[model samples]
Target: MSVRQLLYLAPIAAVLLASSSVVNGQDGVAEELVVLTDLAGLGRDENSVTYFKASNAGAYERFGESIALSADGTTLAVGAIFEDSSATGVGGDQADFSAPNAGAVYIFTRTGSNWSQQAYIKASNTGASDRFGLSVALSHDGDTLAVGALGEDSAATGINGDQHDNSIDNAGAAYIFTRENRTWSQQAYIKASNTGRIEEGDQFGYDVVLNGNGDTLAVSAISEDSAATGVGGEQDDDSAAEIGAVYVYSRDGADWSQQAYLKPRSFSTEMLIGGILFGFAIGMDESGNTLAISGFNEETNRGSIYVFERAGSDWFEQARLVASNPEIGDGLGSAIAVSADGNTIAAGAFDEDSALVGIVPSDQGIDDQRTDDAIGAAYVFVRRGDTWSQQAFIKPTNTQVNQHFGWTLALSLDGDTLAVGAHFENGGSTGINGDQRDTSAQDAGAAYVYSRSGTTWTPRAYVKASNTFARAEFGSSLALNDDGTVLAVGAPREADGAAGINGNQAADSAAESGAVYIY
Candidate 1:
């Protein structure tokens, strides 16, 4: 019998079919031994990378400080929290450097593996040091966008209130933008409903989240300092400092109204000082009926996640989740994601000090493990009727201290896939599943992907920046498409200053220029 070779290629990765082996980085360097067989479809190409930066990129802009992806992954929004552009609204002047740390958001659209800049966005009333892009969110279809300016000084209250008022200092504000066809226009300028009575330093837009339909929004004010608890509580009381709060808003036609104001209950308030973050992370299901808000209790140095469900026009707390064997400083709720159905939730304890390795069974909270300090861990929980329970515990195959494995995470629409980021990982490896043992590149960053089959979760891929560099923070932020087939990884500290995709990535010319990677 004659010997023969069989060949196969993923339909989505057909462009790379010419090359049997996968290459890493845009430098045209084959830094890995990975081949197409290992990839095997799902529209994933570990070897592929599309790099992006601000069109008017300057050093320390932190172009990828925040990021969001449309459900299909064709549209992307990148926030340059330190971007200096003083431009107001969409498609304004990006060259002027009058406004320092003003922040800006850049939108991009992809077609057949090619990405193009769609718009450059700024707050409606641009101001210096506003940090307008500190946080950003996009709707499923990319028709609606929200930008947070945690340093915004306006004391304006309600929707589309006065944006020119600079009376309040750091009261924070959020902006809503809607797209018609390919053009985008500002829809509203939102401030905390208690803006005037709250004084200043609330940081209302510290974090923001938008549902798939683009009609619902949840914004976090990490340092609201309210003694009030529960929804629609007394906002006038600011005695309890740093209590934090989350605001919900709903859109009808083109109008937006505040739906609810949520504050923590029995939360540790004394230690809320020293920059402790409460209600620092927020997540919402596609339908906007489910919400998960994570808060860190500074007193215990531990964290808790609060779940809420919506009924008619009211929102009520469902449960307060804590790690089964949570140790002090676990930081379990730094990052979180809720599935489309609102049944599956993944929470990240980026500060977790677990020394456990590999894919362990569901719920390992009983294990009193610690050696790799700040190695990080993630817990998956599934809801049944009105009950919620942990389903799986995840750690990387190679566990190392200071890895921060679960710093950020995302879930597919169906809740079948998950991606976790470790921006502090010190691996020099490139492409997927490379050498994680190397600690040469400090904080070069890496990402991990996993898939679920029924109740079992399995490791899928180990991802890294094509041009991995020390202190790049490659996984600082992450976003996944509806099907989890596409991913966007932000490396805010990436040194390459070049703008647009496929630019020179090997140079360390632009310090802190930041970059985004598409896979």
Candidate 2:
């Protein structure tokens, strides 16, 4: 298949959100949130800017498919999974098109409101179809990065192994890089340690995350199958059939090693279908002491998330979370985000149907009416000692069917602010708090921001693209800075072919070329 066709086969993931509005605690007041379309020559207090493919046009690069932000909001990482550059490493010729779909990551640094491209990174052993930037994560200090290449076919099993050995198709691998004095070097190459044999569809690095100190790392091999129940248990058994697994690795000095292997308490029977039960989302605290993994197709597509807590060097499952009113096809864990402390979690059920507004009653029975099908809902949970309980159920104020709200989600470090992306929302409203009554822009997408004061959560702002157009998918992915002061929204299907900062967003110029907006 062609690179563009293969790109469509990859699963869609969720994102984090940042905001320009602030909510005052008294009388539910919200301050005006500034929205900027172009980031050219903007100051620190400016609203936002849009970025697109800088070096090439009409390549179907998908520039904003995945994004990550440094804790301080001074650095940003954007991934273009379909980028066809053959660049080998940092600062290489970005115009090289010798390789197709090898992928690339762009690093931007901010100094007093000015943002400049710092690095262009790719896999050390770049090859056609590697898709190196399929997913990207950065350390809190912005010195370390983990890049996932889900289409990589290497069969090597450990760190820094031979990536040239492409014997297993789509077995997948992740590369680690560390920065010293602003220069980056390949630190490690990681893959599943206990897959037993090279499996064609294992996708070991579909999602990667690093702790604040950059010492502990987590990678989800959503396609990993073994009868393994917990840490170090029967990984050779293929009978489990795509049961899915998460691997934890710890860093001591400059060396990395696998610490534990985690799997769901009950193997998902949907494994027979192959792709649905993959570990779709993952979240961890800054200390790496707590971890949450979401399986979007678990339990007959009701979806579930497993929470684990670290005890010394070993990790143990602490709780299993599901929607209070579980219904088939709700997609409960399609998107998830955790607070910096890991005590609070927000999971999205994009297909959840409930006409009722904010904070649904906890014990309400499931309704089969499907009146609000695909309007979507997000659930919030807070940890108290060893127990986690549902704290809230969130929905948009103007709920519309098929909006697919909560297709992506992000939470502030302190868990006080939340952002939910409804990529299919039809409202033509532009910027923050515009009219939702206008249905002229179909699938134009919108994002919602919520703030929590104590235990009460209130809707704060509604966000949309400045050039709202049908099928833009504006809220497809999101990334938020630690304090939620900065947000990046991706509209991979955006037609404007403008490159770099604030170029002309001409109509139908760059179909599916993609664009990213920072706020």
Q: Report, for every candidate in turn, its global Cα lDDT versus the true structure.
A: 0.77, 0.73
Candidate 1, clashing residue pairs? none
Clashes counted in candidate 1 amount to 0
Model 2 lDDT tens row, 98-121: 888888887777788666777889
**Total backbone clashes of candidate 2, pairs 3 or more residues apart or in separate chains:** 2
TM-score of each: 0.90, 0.89
Model 2 TM-score is 0.89
Please give, for residues 257-277, the per-residue lDDT of candidate 1 as tens digits.
999998765544454443335
Instruction: Name every residue pair that clashes in candidate 2.
Output: 16-478, 39-49
Worst 10 residues of 2 by lDDT: 37-46
